[model samples]
Target: MEPCPECGASMDPRSCDELFHALLALDHSRQAPWGPLHGVSVSCFLLQHPSRLPADDGAMAWALLHTYLEGGLDEVNQLVGQARRDNSHRVKGGPLRVVRDAPLPHRDASRSRFSVTIQDVAVDGTFPSSAFTERVKAWAAATVDAWSCGT
Candidate 1:
């Protein structure tokens, strides 16, 4: 195995493959085949790459970033679901907000904006840093092309 120039560390293909699989598991799916890999995958990767411990600042930093991003995605989904529910509700509580362009007042006030202001609704939950939130939004938008919006 050749040394990774970035950190002067030998790159083990097996460990890299495991890391990739672990990353894939971070994506939310009802059929998440990877199950809970939080410590197991990290430990396995570190076992194969002894010189590259999981807690190494670089690796830990990436893990933190990954968790932050995953958390952000969950929040985005929650917001989207809240908006959907609010639209179906008989009263105000969730993501429903009044819009100036609407002709009807009651139901039109429940429409959600497909803009950054969607994050301003304050649905009661903590979030990652604003920078992480912005990155997650960008990631969602970019990946939308890869997902099917069909019935």
Candidate 2:
């Protein structure tokens, strides 16, 4: 199987479909303990699969990733809520205005993107809550690390 060109992660089903399903299961299942991790999971997935979004949405994804890397879900969620509440920036049904508000990084075209892949997130296995939490954190850290060099 071919790996993702952006992140270099190979999946059983191509083009990140399996990864989409995995994130859906984690975020949508009320009975699942992974709900709180939804933000971080989405951030990691979007950052890796930058093709999933347009440029502005991509900026929002990067913003979320930085927030998650800084303070986990709590920090990111707080920012999201604040974004929703700020009516001036709010769209009737569009992306949060925080995209415009956030301090976007300067990307160097000379530098290649993303050294970290979503491969470390482990979509197949059933992990206990604590283990999964640590795994997600590691994934976020690694992704952030890979992008730390002014990417």
Candidate 3:
């Protein structure tokens, strides 16, 4: 196995192929909404280029994830705003707020690798422990499987 230049994640030659297929699956599947995994996929695609690594993979991943989440929040906020304009009484929450802890980026230069953990997520000031968590996990698992199976 070789280390990915950008994130330093150890990857076999097949890893890139796997990543490519994963991206394709995400593109095709309606079940996979635009979110963290999309960000990760884009980052991986950019960083895993054979020619050069664009930036630290781990940092890029977190940055993309943050961007994706923020974009989602913006969409939700827009929807809520639209709802308020349409019918003031129909909207339940004034606005949905999403909050999450900063991702912790860990890297080992010697191994040319990096990883991150998303600590928590909250929607409307409440932890949706199951739904949100499960979505992320399922997306990640699917991504891994997509690549591992060489599909």
Candidate 4:
């Protein structure tokens, strides 16, 4: 396994269930501005790692899901721009593509807060068909639960 770019610790690619549970266990509130970016950076790193692709499809989905859930569209855009500019060695298919293709969460006009669901966005074509997956959908559902609980 290769060392994570955000943290020098070695990381192995995780399955969708593993990634979902791990993220759920984290105190994302403490992760703040940089924590979300760190996840994106790590996914990008795994995508570029010579060892293998590192199951980065799930990783990228997780990162993008959380970024949109927590920081909304602006933060997602910032991370996407960073990944595009910083990871020069990236190929055509990578986390950057996921970030670029994924839909940005929007605030519902009727609701004061951004209450839009992944399913709604996906059905409406805001989220590209390719980027919307079971894993990403699960993450978005979990995010909704977390937000409702005020955690």
Candidate 5:
């Protein structure tokens, strides 16, 4: 398989999508320790794949990621309900929307240019709730760090 142009992970082998879907699956266990961090995981994934996002959604992803960067989980937790209510479609526990309001043809950025991706973290396999939660935060933090470098 070829490396993903955005995150540099191998494609078709379920690299990024695997991690994202696993995090998305956490909706059934929102009461679990890793539940609340789903937004972070979602934002990180969307931000890494800029081409899939429209211009407006790209801005939303950046703002959402920035919120996690500045306020941590407590702040991100505050935005979760609003994101869900913004659209009828479910994103599991992800931030904002997984399905964009606009098409990707007029996107703001074609490339993500991220320094960090799911590849940068130990996201494979299973983990205890607390450890899984930590990895989500770590992935988000790494995404923010990439933004900080203006990538």
Candidate 6:
């Protein structure tokens, strides 16, 4: 479905969910080993910040459930590292933490902050702090993409 041309707001959750599911299903059909993304759940929210206001900040986020046959946590750790490095160059506040987490992502009551907790589904163990920060970065990017279609 097309987004709102004026404000770019597509306030339909079903449409967004269907689009994401369809994309994942089609992609999985061609790639047999694409198990990193087992399932995903997405929801949208309006971003409101008093200090830094976004131009058109309707945000969409996804809860990605992933599974890896071999070295799952290891791979997530690597991705997290990359995310942290990338985010550092963008934000001036310092750095964000990304790690293997358990609790689902959530927005703070104040609506000023949010977080995504990626639990290590692997049997190995919890991931390191430095590595976890990277995951946060990746998740943020993905969330932004899923929300606005880069508009």
- The top-ranked prediction according to TM-score is 2
Candidate 2 Cα errors over 4 Å, as ranges: 13-15, 87-95, 99-102, 106-116, 123-130
- The number of clashing residue pairs in each candidate reads 0, 0, 2, 0, 0, 8
Residue pairs with clashing backbones, model 2? none
Q: Once model 2 is optimally superposed onto the true structure by TM-score, how far is the C-alpha of residue 150 displaced, in angstroms?
A: 5.1
Report lDDT per candidate.
0.32, 0.62, 0.39, 0.40, 0.60, 0.32
lDDT of 5 at 72: 76
After TM-score superposition, the amount by which residue 80's alpha carbon in candidate 5 deviates from its true location, in angstroms, is 3.9
Residues 42-144 of candidate 3: C-alpha lDDT, one tens digit per residue: 4444433423333443343334444434555354344445434645556566542223333423332222222321211122222233465454443333323
Winning model by lDDT: 2
Candidate 4, residues 42-150, lDDT tens digits: the string is 3322322313334443445445656766676477778677766656674554444454443322212121222322223233322333433433434354443433343
Misplaced by over 4 Å in model 1 are 1-31, 54-151
Q: Estimate, for each residue in 1-151, the C-alpha lDDT of model 5 and write its tens digit.
A: 8788777776554667776666567644776765666566667788777657654656556666667767777666665556557654643553445332322223433344555566554344343454666666667767656555553
TM-scores vs. true structure, each candidate = 0.21, 0.72, 0.33, 0.29, 0.64, 0.26
Candidate 6: minimum summed lDDT over ten consecutive residues — where? 56-65
- Per-residue CA lDDT of candidate 1, range 8-87, in tens? 23345333444335344553332332222223223323322335643332233233223324554354344445445666
Give the lDDT of residue 12 in candidate 1: 51
Ranking by TM-score: 2, 5, 3, 4, 6, 1
Q: Write the residue-wise lDDT of candidate 6 on 1-151 in tens digits.
A: 5643222335243332344344355336644222233222112222212122122121111222221112343565464455567567676765443333323323332232222312221112222333433453443443434333323
- On TM-score, the stronger of 5 and 6 is 5
